[model samples]
Target: MGKIIISENVTLDGVVEDPTGDEGSVSWFTRIGDADRAAWAEVEHEEAVGAAALLMGRRTHAYFLHRGWASRTDEWADRLRALPKYVVSSSAVADAGWGEATVLAGDVVKEVAKLKEEVTGEIVVYGSGKLVPALLEHDLADELRLMIYPFVVGTGARLFPETSAVKPARLIGARPVGTALALLTYELVHP
Candidate 1:
């Protein structure tokens, strides 16, 4: 079975929303220097290269499409454009149009469980705020790769919601990705 990995860019306080500050929120991601940003990009590219496919929510899929990330000429962008994508959405979408993608609109748990059985290697999820929480709740997510920024956004969307049931995760890797960013990888332990 393939591993479902939730990869996210989060702030120090665990906020995962408004990385670009386009929504009038503080953009902690862009606060870092150019070299630091480049370092983070390099790390992201490596992750992309290792991933067998990309998974995300409809909003995130649209956000990247609208921003023209698929249209870029860089190696990282090209890799993203080439990968197969799966978008979790409620509405019907004939085609993703970004690349080889399919819209998953049925029971998310069933669809993702089947996807894990069908594919091999890492199935990486990026910026799927709603989907991530649901996946975790359903015990569908296998791993989490978080790129933590230095700034703490006082208020915004969070990666982990308030949960009474403790989800046990084993730390697999941890490293600094520049002067201001840190990359932490955790493997979720299921009972």
Candidate 2:
């Protein structure tokens, strides 16, 4: 079965919402120093090559489709545009115009499990704030690749919700990049 990996950019305080200022707040972009840019480049390259397919939530999909991954020639755009995309959403109506895009409307766990069985490479989830907690609840995520930024957003959507159970994860690797960012990889331990 393929591994389900979550590659997310989070703040020091664990906020994951609208860091690029495309969704709501512009604070994250402004606070991102030169060091943060270098860290982001490393994280992006790692995720781009590691993932075989991209799994996203509705909001994230919409945001990225409009802003980041829309152009075919953008950096990391080819990988994103070429990879098969699975979007979990109840309200997203339009298909992602690049590659094979499918809407997973059934039980998230069941659908993801089926995908894992069929796919060959790593099934990656990026910035799927709403879907991350659900996947975690179902024990669907195998790995977590987090790029921890320096600044702390006092209030915003978080990567992990409070309702989630405390699950222990083994640290697989850590790389300090730029000045204040750390690329941390963790493997989820099933109990």
Candidate 3:
């Protein structure tokens, strides 16, 4: 079976929302600076190349599909545009222009498991706050690759929401990218 990995950008306090100051609570994009952007670019490039498919929530999918990865000529744009994308949302509608996007309508875990079986490479989830906890709860996520920024945002969407039950995970690796960001990889330990 293929691995389901979450690749997210989070603050020290675990805030994962509106980092680009795009009308949200905390501004993480401003804090990242130029050097940090370069580091992130490198990380994204590597991840994009390895991932066979991209899974995202409605908001995140619309954001990237409209903003950065829409154009085929845009930097690292082809990587995102080419990959098969799955969007999970009950209310929000998807853009018709975004190529090869399938809305996940049924049971999220079952759908994801079906996708994992079909995919040959890594199945990557990016900035899907609502979907992450569900993935974890269902024990569907195989790995987590977090780009942890040093700054703390006290209020915003968190990377990991509080769960009633404990799901064990093991730290597999850590790599410091520039001064502010660290790439942390963790593997879920199945019982």
Top candidate (TM-score): 1
Model 3 per-residue lDDT at 184: 95
Higher-lDDT candidate of 1 and 3: 1
- The TM-score obtained by model 1 is 0.95
Candidate 1's displacement at residue 21, Å, is 1.2
Q: Which residue pairs does candidate 2 place in steric collision?
A: none
- Residue 78 CA error for candidate 3 (Å)? 0.6
lDDT of 1 by residue, 59-89 (tens): 8888888887856889999899888889899
Candidate 1 yields a Cα-based lDDT of 0.89
Error of 1 at 73 (Å): 0.2
lDDT of 2 by residue, 90-188 (tens): 754465565657889888889899998988889999888889998898888999998887787798888888755787899999988777778899999
Number of the candidate with higher lDDT, 2 or 3? 3
Candidate whose lDDT is highest: 1
The lowest-lDDT stretch of 10 consecutive residues in candidate 2 is 91-100
When sorted by lDDT, best at the front, the candidate numbers are: 1, 3, 2
TM-score of each: 0.95, 0.90, 0.92
